[model samples]
Target: MTTHYLLNKLRQENPLVHSITNQVVSNDVANSLLAIGASPMMAMAPEEMEEVTKFAKAVVLNIGTLTTEILEAMLIVGKAANKKGVPVILDPVGVGATQFRQEAVSMLLKEVTIQLITGNAGEMAYLAGIDWSSKGVDAGEGKASGREIAERVARRYQTVAAVSGKEDFVSDGRMTIGILNGDPMLTRVTGTGCMLSGICGAYLAVGGKPVLESTVEACTAYGVAAEIAVENKEVNGPGSFRASLIDALYNLSEQTIRDKENIKRYHVNKSEEGTNE
Candidate 1:
């Protein structure tokens, strides 16, 4: 299926997304999902995790502000979603900053079957067991390229991995697709990456394409929205850009995605590991 076809299906289905994300960007995450025609349920109570997972078409687990209670809720919700055959998307925010965060990610990966993982280059590098210099939540300098990290992470976790940066790359242990569509202003806004994770969950919930295609679609759509948001003359800075971004998502069209998306496909061969763009 085509990327626009999956996007149109997501809008038509309006799937429910259960997000166990940090408090800092919960509002943005919810609003972004709603803007893309998905119902967002920011429910974190461990007591009701199973029930909420039962009703959710997709689950997003973000570890931006990690806590014991929040971690517990994520585990419960992730496992429940797994049992129901629902897609689970993980955003390991600031994972390399602390040992606790690293351990938390390891635990979650051990117990939960994540369908897709969305994070910056540094985060994906850490998950792939590569040596990367991470500065808090930002994607610090890394020796390995984003494509390498994404492919390694996908192979290690047995799922789709997406690394977002100036250019976005999504891999499924076989092929990696690079998307060049977003703007630099996206980095100025808080929770933009988190919001993209929520969007990935929504696309996966629609379930018309493979996990890799769904993730690429999510990244492309999000990047296109950011590019459109920054094109408005009214957007001067982060505040205006953030507001305009939501409007862009709300008004996003399949034709726009088709016309503006800049994507390149690369085949990943185990014997000869090199990018063939």
Candidate 2:
């Protein structure tokens, strides 16, 4: 799937995305949305979350830096999105890292009708009820691939799932897509996953079979931006990489995503264990 078309569409439409994200990358999320031509509203106050959801085309829920109040707000907005039929994208930031985190993620899932769940390998495995390891607030040690777990959870929940690692995987129970165009440096900086989830929400807002296509395009768009940002050696550190990433996003063009996208996709093999099938 080519990202060029979707990127252009998102830019032209400038969808409004309401985010109930962690404090760690709220600023980065907002900036990434702006760079990609989407308008973002970071509304945490429970009093206004429902109202905010009413206006947004889609909603993103992240648990990187969760608070009781933030969780409460998420419930409000998530329900509102469901009632309005807007997509709800969930980012299980660190599900297996702590009991509290796991419980919170579980609670949220039980309450909301999630349209998508994006996370790393460890988080995806744990959420799928498989044993996994994690390092405080970070993806833990695990042999279960994110792609494998994403497909399972997505199928079970009847929702779209994206598991990001060296190769990112996106699935909606039937089709499974693998995107391989990101720079490893993305992991060094915080909130890239969060930003990707927000971007996915933006794509969901646009509507169509295009939702999955939009997600694949967004991932490629981000990877291409990372590739472009790392082209210069002098700016190698996180600080430089951060700015360069934003600049890359800001200057991203349709041709660039289409030209640089390194995505491979196929159907799952039903007989294979722990495989997308």
Candidate 3:
């Protein structure tokens, strides 16, 4: 299915997305999901996690503010989602910052059959086991390009992976796509990546196409919305831009996505490298 069609399906279906995410971005994540016509259920209580996962069409797990209790809850939700065949999107935020975060991510990957993984370059690089300089939640510097990191992560985990940066890259082991439509202002805001992960859940829940295609569409749609948000003259800074971004997501049109989308496809070599064409 086309990206536009998938987006329409999401609005029409209004799937339930159970997001067990960090406290820092829970509100924004829910708002972003709502803006995209998805029902967001930010249920973190361990008692309700399995029940919520059963009802959810998708589950998003974010390790932004990792804690032992949160990790346990994520595992419960993720396992339940897997059993129910609900798509699960994982965002390993600031994973390289601490051994605890790394261990948490490792445990999640081992226990859950993740449908898609979304994060910045550093996070993806850490998952891909590449050498990258990480500073907290930031992407930091990496020798491997975002496309390479995304592809490696996908192959390593046997799942689709999306790396967000100046340009966003999505891969499902074999093919990788790049989206260049976002603005620098996105970095200035908190929870933008977290919100994008929630949006990814929405798209995956719609599920008309392959997981890779859905993920690529999600990243493209988000970047396009960012571009639209930044174009508003009233958006003078991150604060205004954040508000405008929600508005953009709420008003995002298929026509706008088609017009503004800057996507490029790359073929992945079996040698675990991506060649842009």
Put the candidates in lDDT order, highest first.
1, 3, 2
Alpha-carbon lDDT, every model: 0.92, 0.83, 0.90
lDDT tens digits, residues 1-277, model 2? 5636767777889999998887888999999998988999998899998778768999999998888888898889999999999989999888787787888888988999998898887878877777777776577777777677877887777777888889998887667889998898899998888988888888788776455666777777888898998886767688899888888998999888878888888686666434422
lDDT of 2 at 44: 88
- Model 3 local distance difference test score: 0.90
Index of the highest-lDDT prediction: 1
Assess candidate 1 and give its lDDT: 0.92
lDDT value, residue 87 of candidate 2: 88
For candidate 1, lDDT tens digit of each residue in 1-277? 2457877888898999999887899999999999999999998889999999878999999999989999999999999999999999999999999999999999999999999999999999999889999899999998999998999888888889999999899998898999999999999998999999999999999997899998989999999999999999999999999999999999999999999989999998876343222
RMSD of 2: 2.2
For model 3, residues 1-277, the per-residue Cα lDDT tens digits are 2356778889999999998887898899999999989999987778888888767999999988778888889999999888888999999999999999998999999999999999999999999989999899998997899988988898888889999999899998899898898999999999999999999999999888899999888888999999999999999999999999999999998888988888899888777644321
The runs of at least 3 residues in candidate 2 whose Cα sits more than 4 Å from the true structure, single-residue gaps closed, are: 271-277
Residue 190 local lDDT, model 1: 88
Cα deviation of 204, candidate 1, in Å = 0.4
